[model samples]
Target: MPVLVNSHPSPPLHIDMTPPKPIIAVVTGTGAQGRAVSRAFHDTGKWHVRVLTRNPAGKVAQAFQKEGMEIVKANFEDKASLVKAFEGAYAVYSNTVPPWHQSYTNKLGEYEQGVLQADAAKQCNVQLILFGTLPYVGPEFMGLGGVELYDAKARTNDYITSLGLPAVYISMPAFIDNVHSWPLVKAIDGGAKLEFVGYVVKPDKPMVFLWVERDLGPSVLAIAESFRTFGRPLAEHPLNHNVLPVGSWRGTWGQVSDEIEKQTGIPTIHNVLPSVDQRWHRELTKVFHYQNTHGLFPTDNFPTKVFSSLGVQYGTVEEFVRTKIAPMFRKS
Candidate 1:
């Protein structure tokens, strides 16, 4: 016996060698989609959540900070600032609003900021990069007039892919809240009845709808979990991590109305408008027609397997309208 160790080798020193959790920095993580993404990652308790915003002093930022997130002040136009914010982060989740949405910039600035963000992430050596993008409807020949919103993001997507960076492109759909934002509610019979209009010209056209605030978190969380399980975290270019579209319900607009009535027992009619009467009708009309033909995703979109295990509240159009929409109107 070569001096057999006594007393169980000093009890292994009883040290706390547990490693720190990975960090996830969310860029533009304040709006509907970003807010949901930030909260989803933060709630896991496995991730150190950090959010980047130009205004860290805003009410939304304050609210997010109160919810236990690290808020970093960063501007989309400043690549250096973004890199600083993204430093030490393992993953970056980013979404950019249409510059026109808030009347913030004269020229379409999505492409510019998109490039800056991508460059920053690339420079920072982030392991996973997720961007919110929309697909374009064409082969550069259809000449869709109101497609600038989609086109700007499409350009960004191309740039990111060309960089061969590990990225996830989140293709989002029309928000269920659009009816409220665009306001298609017309008081029928001078308040005797209320009609909520849908964007489809035909009753059978399939449209994809998602209440982003509720569903995006689970959608992104699904991807994050997948990355942890089987995704290529070490590989240089994880091309397999490509476009992931998220939607809650895809059906006729009539189905949406029926669900509202069925769940809330509210009397209402599903009004299908021939054409949208909003200021940007030309583009909106084209968008409707694009869906009428190509559909949002050609081959059976949004597989349920991705998010089935999140164990969170899943929202559907019917439930959304019943709970959120029905309250907007009083008894007829």
Candidate 2:
């Protein structure tokens, strides 16, 4: 049985007051994507961000503390600890990754962690939640193997919906920064060798898309704001559960290979499936092949349009990739 932390007597509703500093509790806020998004939310100064981590005093937690973020120790595997972490939060930007020690390809650990977070948040009276999820057309049209990241997220979505809480779920196609998954990055100075598996059987030319991470934050914020207006639209009122694909301008893998050479001056090579055998690399290759075959393209808007309508101004792929990611290569 889970311990009750802050149960309310009334029906679940977002109590909009003078907009007192928004408290956003982010689970696993120390991770790459979580840290970046939390920093963006904190920079606004209107948000009071609290991070839930197993090691609250570790390097990542310390870094966030220096930035003035509240650190709370909560292990999702422990229900009581998670309950305590969600005690007083207005909204939560939630993410959970598999344990580093785990060797299994299917990330059931991350999936279970998210389920615990959602259950704990519901008990704690959180008004809104901004959740990260993989693409799914319900359970019927699942993509990307429908296991590990995707299946876990789909389960979490079901859990949150059953809680009857107002939630905004964002489905990001793929990260532009996933280039780090390549093994060649280990040998190269500023460049990484890119590879894709699976056949690209399409009328359109074969291509690969890389998503820039910096563009993710503003779009996430936009989704968060949309949750504020959630439930105003009836369930039958064509609720917008939109999917936003984030990548640099759509072009051939050769174009991306050329851009890498131009930007880093390091040779970029694209290898076919047989040449690439790394587990993570193969997973990414599958995603690229699927999206290309499906003719997926990056949107022109910084923040996706549906989210933008909810008042989020998104950043562009070139701007983020050039500023945030490009500097890392220079530093390397």
Candidate 3:
């Protein structure tokens, strides 16, 4: 049986007084992406990772304990809990989850949590922060109207910028790993047709991919190291945020289908260029329609030189899919 722990009374907090060892606290450390980020920092052997969890005895919390990560119970809604969790840390990696279905409300919670953590960091004299955000240009994609999710995050981004803190915001691209939600992963196993609605120029448009949530750890660690160097410098263009479109390639729907066939030894077909009304039954069709129709596709395939200069080498979507994602399917 696994066990969860809460090491609150331990004062003069254990800090690795050596090169490369930084004390960092990650919010919602039990979450998919959060866990990955925590693991990355721990595996580097340079930082002592503290995880924030509301219930530090659940399955996920126990898993982190096994990894030797310090588990702290921190409720996002409770400022005291947050303050307690962030005590004596050198940095805070912010990521929080609130009640689902309330897009606007949940996003507000995320923003508030960040501000609260920053306040705690200020009090503790932490050196840096690493935050995750989406690529949004304010009302740039508002013409479609149903992108409340994007809007909420954009609002949060704006708030973080106003704070004069040493922070690095990783504007992550669309999780190419989101392909799992589509029929592609299933198609990889056997007979299934890949479908897409709307006009997509074949083999020309660059499609970017992000790994599944699990593999986001090392990437987040790299970003944390970057923030340690960049410090709390205000971004020249704050509201207008961008992402590095990694694991992105220009290919058509046909090409994607062909690739699937090649990989799985199966025949893959697509409906291709259907009437707007004929698009596939996507649960988030409204969001996708709005983004695609307005040509506001979100991807991060920027030149590697920018990241290389920062000493961050992120994984490619292909590598993430083949090495990380495909394995999930095998397990299932």
Candidate 4:
């Protein structure tokens, strides 16, 4: 005989909860690129943002922490710290500062740090590793013999791929904000008219440019979303999976200068030097030569389909100057 208790069903249970967001660990989050990535993920509200920085008390780190994101103190030189910081992260964005900027004469330091970060990500079992990389212009390339910066990034790119961890390489070209740092801008600040200098490349030679602060975050977010939607199998996708060279626009120095004049109402003059003889010029000349000859990433093409599918819009140089650059100059 079965004993049946008249147990009336209690009130229907009501529980509402959303799934947890994916965790993204951003290395060197105190810097420009890393900070942009952190903000991007934060804005989406789709991922939990954890930033790894050597200086957790730094201004930028504090700002990020105040935004309710996790801040983990980790040094690039310390692999253990990186591994610990990377633990439980679904994806990791690793970017290393140039050695010269850190007062180190050795260029190989960038490559070493990149490898260390990649190894940590692998150990932590990160599903995706996005490396900030650049094209390698080696000695084998006709005009790029002395460009150590490009070569170092190229080596790091190779090392990241060698790890066989699901990875995406984001290659940033020259930043449009660099115009503000140029001597020409300094001269403008000193009440001189805008006078620009172009090295080996012709005035009409097109150069790829990016507005890092605005574009980087959106670009990274789009990439992450693409990875999630397509899954790990897309890592082996021939076109969309591998390297993404990101730039807002492409224009010649002449066109850039013209835009500056049009936006600021200040006439601009540009000088194209026939050859570079100064040490700085000589070093950079090789880079320009390589860019002109081999071209930066085959006709300055970007992953259009990926960006379009993600509905991410990249800004134009004119728009950047008018909206972002002009305001600063106006204030000054």
Model 2 clash pairs?
176-210, 176-211, 303-314
User: What TM-score does structure 1 among the candidates reach?
Assistant: 0.81
Q: Better model by TM-score, 1 or 4?
A: 4
Candidate models: Cα lDDT each: 0.71, 0.59, 0.56, 0.75
Ranking by TM-score: 4, 1, 2, 3
- Which candidate leads in TM-score? 4
RMSD score of candidate 2 (Å): 10.7
* Residue 69 local lDDT, model 1: 88
Residue 266, model 2, lDDT: 53
Q: How many clashes show up per model?
A: 0, 3, 12, 0
lDDT of 1 by residue, 176-271 (tens): 776666665545776656676766546566777778777887787766666655634434434345766777767766676666566545566777
lDDT: which candidate is best? 4
CA lDDT of 247 in candidate 4?
Answer: 79
Better of 2 and 3 by TM-score: 2
Give the better candidate number (2 or 4) by lDDT: 4
TM-scores for candidates 1 onward, in order: 0.81, 0.70, 0.69, 0.82
**lDDT of candidate 4 over 1-332, digit per residue (tens):** 99998699789888878877889999888677888889999988889999988778989889889988999998877789889999999889988766646322334477788888989998998888888887877687783454765777678778877877777888877667656644334235464466666667676876777777788889988888877777447556444437778877777767877777777666667877755556244545676787666556656554355566678788887887787656654434
Q: What does candidate 3's lDDT look like per residue over 1-332, in tens digits? A: 87968766566668786674578898778765677778888887788999887679989889879988899987766667777887778778776443343221343354565677667766676666666654454445544443444544455555655665556665554455445543344533343433322233233344444453544666566556665555444243231233333323323344454454454444545443422224333223444444344323333334245455545555544454465434433332
Q: Kindly report which residue stretches of model 1 are placed more than 4 angstroms away from their true locations once superposed.
A: 1-16, 103-108, 139-142, 180-191, 199-201, 229-233, 236-239, 264-266, 269-285, 301-313, 330-332
